[model samples]
Structures are given as structure tokens and as C-alpha cells.
Target: KWTWSAVFTLQWLGLSIAWLDGAEVLYTYYYPTHIVLVGVTVSLIWRYYGR
Candidate 1:
């Protein structure tokens, strides 16, 4: 869980830095990756804590 949290945090941080650095071209690619990560994170949390 912490591993995923760290990954999610780092992913956002990298995305923010890239956007601030004028890397808009990467946004298209990052969007889908971000969505998938979010989905996985949510499912993992539900599966772990929904007991």
C-alpha cells in the first residue's frame, strides 16, 4: 500500500514538474497512465479495506 502511495505521489510530482516545464506533449500520454493508476489504487484500497 505504501509502495503504491509512493508511486502515485511521485507520478503526480513528475507530471506537475513536466507540465511546469512546458512538456505539454507528454500530457496525452500521462493522462491515460494517471487514470489507470487511479483505478488500480482505488481497487486496491477497496479490496484491502472493504472487509
Candidate 2:
């Protein structure tokens, strides 16, 4: 179940980043912020469970 949840979380995060990037036609920082957040989330999850 945790693996499924992790995959779902990753997909949702990717979709979120895509949405933010798509929405930020002017304030381009939004894309980078979303990417950073997604990176941090993935890294944290990996750090905790990647062993």
C-alpha cells in the first residue's frame, strides 16, 4: 500500500507542477517553485524509504 501511495503521490506532484507551470505564463517563478517542492518531496521520500 505504501508503494502505491508513493507512486500516486509522485504522480500528483508531477501533475501539480505541470499545472503550476502551465498557469504561470507571466510569473514564471511558479514553475521553479513547484519543481523545487516536488524535488524536495521526492528526495525526502527517498531518503526515508530508499534503503
Every model's Cα RMSD, please? 2.4, 5.0
lDDT of 2: 0.67
Question: Which tens-of-lDDT digit does each residue in 1-51 have in candidate 1?
Answer: 687779779788869876876757457667778788788888988998899
Each model's lDDT: 0.77, 0.67
List the candidate 2 regions with Cα displacement exceeding 4 Å. 1-27
Instruction: Evaluate residue 49 in candidate 2 and report its C-alpha lDDT on the 0 to 100 scale.
Output: 91
The alpha-carbon lDDT assigned to residue 51 of candidate 2 equals 86
lDDT string, candidate 2, 5-51, tens digits = 77568667766776766855424655565567668778977898998
